[model samples]
Target: MSPLLAADEPSNLPDLEILRAEVGSAWSAYQDTKYTRATRLIPGILADAQRAVRSYEGDAQLQAKALLAMAYQGAAMVLTKIGEADLAWMAADRGLGAAQESGDRVVTGSLFRSVAHCLLSNGRLTAARDLVTDSAGYLEDGLPDASPTYVSVYGTLFLVGAVAAARLDDRATVRAFLAEADAAAQRLGQDANHMWTAFGPTNAAIHRISAAMELGDVQVAADQGPRVDSSTLPLERRVRHTLEVARAYSAQNRTDEALALVLDAEELAPEQVRYHFISRHLVTAWVRQQKGKPSHQLAGVAQRLRIVG
Candidate 1:
C-alpha cells in the first residue's frame, strides 16, 4: 500500500462529524485563498477518510467516504490551479469513486464538476465538455420538483459545462447550458452556498461574464460587469470574477481599468491572483500596453507574480 493511504499508519481519525467539519473548514480556507493551509490539511484528512471507509460500515462509512471525496475535490482544485494537472486528475478520479460509493448523486456530480475542471486545465477541452455534459444530463431528471440543494448542484454542473463549451468556442452549447443554469438560479431567487456549490442568480451572472469573456465579446462582458456583486461571492470566486472583468477591459483596450482590476484581484486574494493564469496573461498585456515606465506597484505585482523580469 502507498504510505499515504496505508490503513496501518499512525492515524488520528476524527469522528465523522469532526471530519466533515474539517473538510468544510478546508473549503472555507480554499475560498479565502488560504491555499497553503488548505493544501496542508488535505492529505491527513484523505488518509483518515480512506481508513474510515475501509474500516467502518453503514452510514458512518458513507459519511466518511463523502468527506474524503470532498477532500479530494478541494485538493484537485488547488492542484489544477497550480498547474499540476496529472496530480489533480488523480485526486479528482479518487473523489469521483468515493462519491459514487457514498450513493449521493449531488456529491457525485460535484466530483464530476471538479474532474471536468481538472480536464479543462489540462487542455482536454473536448473531454471536459463531454464529461460535464453527461454528468449534467445525469442530474436532469426530476428537476421540476427537486430540492433547492439538488437544483443548485445541477446548476453548478451546467455552469461548469458552459465554461468548457465556451473554451471550445461552441457558442450554441455554451448558451444552452448557461440558460439552463440561469433558470435554476432564478428558481432559487437568491444566492446560496448550498452544499458548497455556491449556485444562485449572482453566481450564474458571474458565469455569464466569464462566458462573455471566453466568447471574446468584450463589449457584452464589460456591459454586464457592473451587475456582479462581488460581496455575494466567496473571496476566491470574487477574485476570479474581477480578473475576468480585467480581461474584458484588456480586450477593449481599457488598459488603465484592466490594470486596476488586476490589482484589485491581487488585493482581494494575493496568492490566488498571483498564481492564476488570467492574472499572468493580464499582467503581460498590461505591461506591454504601457506607453512608458509602469508604476512601482504594477511593476512589483508583475515581478512578484513572475509575469515580468
Candidate 2:
C-alpha cells in the first residue's frame, strides 16, 4: 500500500471550508505541474479531511469525505504521471472508497474516471473499459434531470471508455462510446469543467485525437491535432495535448516536429514531461533512430530526464 493511503490524525484542523479551498488550490498547483508542491500539501489536507469527516455528521460529513476523495484522486493523478502506477492505484482505490461513502453520484462518477485512468495507465485496458462501462450504465438513469456536475461526469465516463475501447482495437465499441459522450457534450453545449471532469465538446474533441492514436491512425491523430486550441484548456490539458501531438508526429517520422512539440510540453509542465513514460520512451526512441548524435536540445532534455546516458 502507498504511504499516502495511510491515515494520519492532524494536529490542527482548519475550518472545513478553508481546508476544502486549500485542497482546490493544491489541485490547481498540480495542474500547473507543481508536483512536489502539490504532494507536500496533500497529506495534511487528507488528514484534516479525515478529521472533519469524523467530527461532523450528515451533510457536513458527506461533503468533507467527498473533498477527501478528490484530494486522493488528485494524488493519484500526480503519482501516475510520475511513473508510480502501483502507488497511484492505491490512492485511486482509497478515493473510490471515500466516494462510495460520500454517496454523491457526481463524486462517485468522477472517482470512477480516476480509477479507469489508473487502470489504463497500468495497461489494464479491458478492466479500464469495463469499469467505465459499468459505472456509466449505473449513472445513466440519473442524467436526464441531473445538474451540470453529473452531466460532465457521465460524459467523461464515456470518454475514458471510448479511449479504452480504441486502445483495445474494438472500433465498434469506441464509436458507440464516443457517440454517447458526444451526445452528453451536445447537451452541455460548451466546454466547462465540473467535478474536474472537464467534459464538453472541446474535451470530447481532445479524446478523438487520443482515440485516433490508440486506433493506430497516426495520420488522423496528427490531422486532428490542430483542431484543439491549447490556450483554451487548462495547463495540464494543454501539456497533454502537446504531448499527444508530439506522439503523433513521432509516429509519422517527423522527428523535428515531434521534438519541438515535446519541448513545448516540457516548457508548459516540466515535472509532468520529465517523469512521464511516454516522454522518456519517445526521446529514447527518437534518439536511437537518428543517424548521428542527437541535437543539443534533444540531448539536453534526454539527459535531464535520464532517458539516455
Candidate 3:
C-alpha cells in the first residue's frame, strides 16, 4: 500500500455513523468551495475510515469501506482542483478499490467518474472517455430496476464522458454522451444530489454548456450558458456554470459582460474563482490586453486571483 493509505496504529474504533458524517462534511466543504477546509478534513476522515474498516466486520465492514471510498473520492476531487494530478490519481485508484470491496455499485460508478476525472486532468482524453463508456455500460445493465443513486451515478458518467469527448473535439461523441445524460435526467424527473452527484435535468443542461465550451462552440455556449438556472444545483456547480458563461462572454469579446459574470462568480465563491485555472487565465489575458491600466474591477479580481502579483 502507498504510505498515503497506510493504516494507523491500532486504536479505538470510530463510530460508523460519526465517520460517515465526517466524510459527508468533507464533501460539503468541497462543494461549498472551501478547498482548504476540505483538504484539511480529508486525511483525518480517511484515517478514521480506515480504522473503522479494520475494526468492523460483515455489513459494518462493508459500510466502513463505503465511507473509505467516499473519503478517498473527496480527496481525489480536492487534489484535482488544486493541481495534484498524481496524488488525485492515487486517491481515485484507492477509492475504486474500496468501492469494489464495499459492493456498492453507486460508489463504484462514482469512483469511476473520479478516475476518469484524473485521466482528464492528465490529458488522457481517449482513456477518460473509454473508462466512462465501459463503466457506464456495466452499470447500465442495472437500469431496469435502478435506484435513484444508480441513475444519478450512471447519468453523471455520461456527463463527464461528454466533457472528455468535447476536449477531444469529437462533436458526435459529445452529443451522444449528452443525449444519454439528458435521457437519464429526464427519467430521474427532477434535480437531486443523489450520492453527491447533482445529476438532473438542470445539471445536464449545465454540462451541455460545458461541452459546448470545450468543443469551441462559442455561439452555442454563449447562447445557452446564461439562460440555464443553476440555482437549484450545488454551490460548486452553480459557480462553475457561472464561470463557463463568463468564458463564453469573453470569447465573444463582450468584455464588460464577461467581467461582470466573473465578478458574480467571485461573489458566489471567491475561493473557486481564485483557484480555478479558467478564471485565472481569463484575468491574465484581460490584464495583458489592456492598453494601459486595467479597470478597477478587473484589477481587483486580478489581485484576488494573484495574477497581478
Candidate 4:
C-alpha cells in the first residue's frame, strides 16, 4: 500500500495492470493540463483502491494497517489539494479509523500526521498541531528510528509544525520546522530509490515553497521553485506550482507576470478540476486585486469557486 497511490480515484475497476496503466496515464494527463480527461478518471481509481483494502486478508497487523492507512492518506491528499475540504477530512478520518483498527503504533503515527495535514490544509492549524504532537508520542513507542517510514512520519510532523507557525506568522518557527522537514527528507537520500521517495522530493519542495511564501519570502520561493519545473508537473502539480509562482511574482510587484500566469493557469486547467480552480483562483483574485488598487483595479472578472471536500 504505497501512500502515493491514495491521491486520486481511478475511473474504472481495472486489475493491477490496468489500474497502474490508468494511474500512469492520468498522471501524465494531469501534468499536461488535461483535467477534462484526468478528472473523468480519478474518482473511480480512488474508490477502487479504497475498496481493495477491504479484501486484505493478511495476518500481519502492521503491514495491513500500514497499507490501509496509506490508502486513506492518498485519498485525503487528492481531496485536500483539490480544495475538497469535507471529503479530504473524511478520508483522513477513515485513515485514522483503519489505523485504530490494526493497532499499529507506527501506522497510527502516520495516520495522525496525515489527518493533521488535511486539517492544516483546511485552515485548522491548532487541531493540526495537537494531532502532530499526539503522533510524536506514537513515534516514540518502539518505532524503529531508521525506517524510511519513520523518517517520513517525522517529516510530516515538521510539516505540521511549519503550518502551525505559518498560521501564527512566526517566521523563526516556520523556518525551523521547514528546514527540519527538508533535512529529514534528505536523510532518506540513502534510499533515493525507495518508493516512498519517488514523489516525496517534489511534493516536499512544493510545501516548502508554500511555507516560504507564507513566511513572506516570495523571492526565495521563486528562486527555489524553478527546480520544480511547473510545465513538466502534472495537472494538479502545475496548477499548484503555477499559483505559487504567481504568488512569488505578485510579491515582487511583477503584476503583469502574476496576472498573466494566473490567466494562463486558468486557461490551461478546467473547472471540473476544482483543485486547480479554487486554490489557484483565490491567489489569482488576490493578485489581481492587489494590482488594481491605489490607482487601477483589475477589471472584467467573474469568479466561480466551489468549496468541496
RMSD of 1: 2.1
Instruction: Report lDDT (CA) for all predictions.
Output: 0.84, 0.85, 0.91, 0.61
Model 1 TM-score is: 0.94
Report the number of clashing residue pairs per model: 0, 0, 0, 23
Q: TM-score of each candidate?
A: 0.94, 0.94, 0.96, 0.66
227 Cα displacement, candidate 3 (Å): 1.0
Q: How close is candidate 3 to the true structure, as a TM-score?
A: 0.96
Better of 1 and 4 by lDDT: 1
Candidate number achieving the greatest TM-score relative to the actual structure:
3
Score candidate 3 by lDDT.
Answer: 0.91
What is the model-wide C-alpha lDDT for candidate 1?
Answer: 0.84
Tens digits of lDDT, candidate 4, 1-309:
223343333453225445445545544544455545655666665554455444434544344455556556656655565567888788789878877877766566767766887878777777776676567665754535557766766665777667677776877777777776777667765323122223245556777787888777778888897677544334555666777877788778786777677666667664423345434455445634653342222332233333211
lDDT of 1 by residue, 1-309 (tens): 122765443364457888888888878888888888887888877776787788777988888888889889988888877777899999999999999999888788889899989888888989988997888788888576888888888888878878889989999999899999989899888899887788898889899888888888889999888678868778888888888888888888887888888888888788898789999987887777678999897798889898763
Q: Show the lowest summed lDDT stretch of 10 residues, model 4.
A: 190-199
lDDT of 3 by residue, 97-154 (tens): 9999999988999999999999999999999999999998889889999998899999
Name the runs in model 4 displaced over 4 angstroms.
1-66, 103-107, 140-145, 190-205, 222-239, 263-274, 277-309
lDDT head-to-head 2 vs 3, winner: 3
Angstrom error of the Cα, residue 198, model 3: value is: 0.7
Alpha carbon lDDT at 9, candidate 4: 38
User: Cα lDDT for residue 208, model 2?
Assistant: 85
